[model samples]
Target: MKALDRAELQRRFPEGVPVQCGKSSSSHLVSPNEIFAVESKMFFLVGPVGVILSFLSGGVFVYSNWSNVLGDDLAFLFLVPIIILIPWLIAYTFIKNERARISLFNRHYI
Candidate 1:
């Protein structure tokens, strides 16, 4: 981790070095909720890339299995793309919101 500036240390600590926020001074200052929120946002942003790759690979799989499993029912094939797309859309929305929130928080902090 980078060393803290004097002002940040003062704002967060206000007492002395090794000041506690909750548990340990060094380890427990950041909120887990905020960390989770940021991580969830990152997950959302990256999920679509994985989904796209998976969808393409699944198309190949479906093609390989079509004769034995699906027979001639090509209509069911549409469901695969829809399922991939829906989740990606939801994740994109979540990522957008989270990024906005992070930007706003940074602006306020800085």
Candidate 2:
């Protein structure tokens, strides 16, 4: 879809969002929805990257200590679950919060 023009954007989002055009040192005032959209998009991108990195790091740790890993059955099992879950939980929390924030902003502003 085509991007919204400044006036269209302003009409759609009137609570003053921040927009940074190219080569501009300062951000332009837009609407809350615009800012929230940008922030939510950023969080969406970062969340997956964080999850992938966490899994990779966990894999590396497991591989690096492969010799000792198998011997500690409980530790090994617990490690895998924790490593997988912790990142998932963190990412989930962030996304949830972002959704809630966006929802609230939409309700109040747009």
Q: Pick by TM-score: which candidate is best?
A: 2
Model 2 pairs whose backbones collide: 17-30, 17-31
lDDT of 1 at 106: 44
User: Which digits, one per residue and each the tens of the lDDT, describe model 2 over residues 1-110?
Assistant: 12233344566556665567788677677554444333447777787888898889889878987886868566776777688778789878887876775465555434
Please give the distance, in angstroms, between residue 18's alpha carbon in candidate 2 and its true position after superposition: 10
Off by over 4 Å in 2: 1-39
TM-score of decoy 1: 0.40
lDDT for 98 (candidate 2):
67
Residue 91 of model 1, lDDT score: 71
RMSDs, each prediction?
A: 9.0, 7.7
Lowest summed lDDT over 10 consecutive residues: which window, candidate 2? 1-10
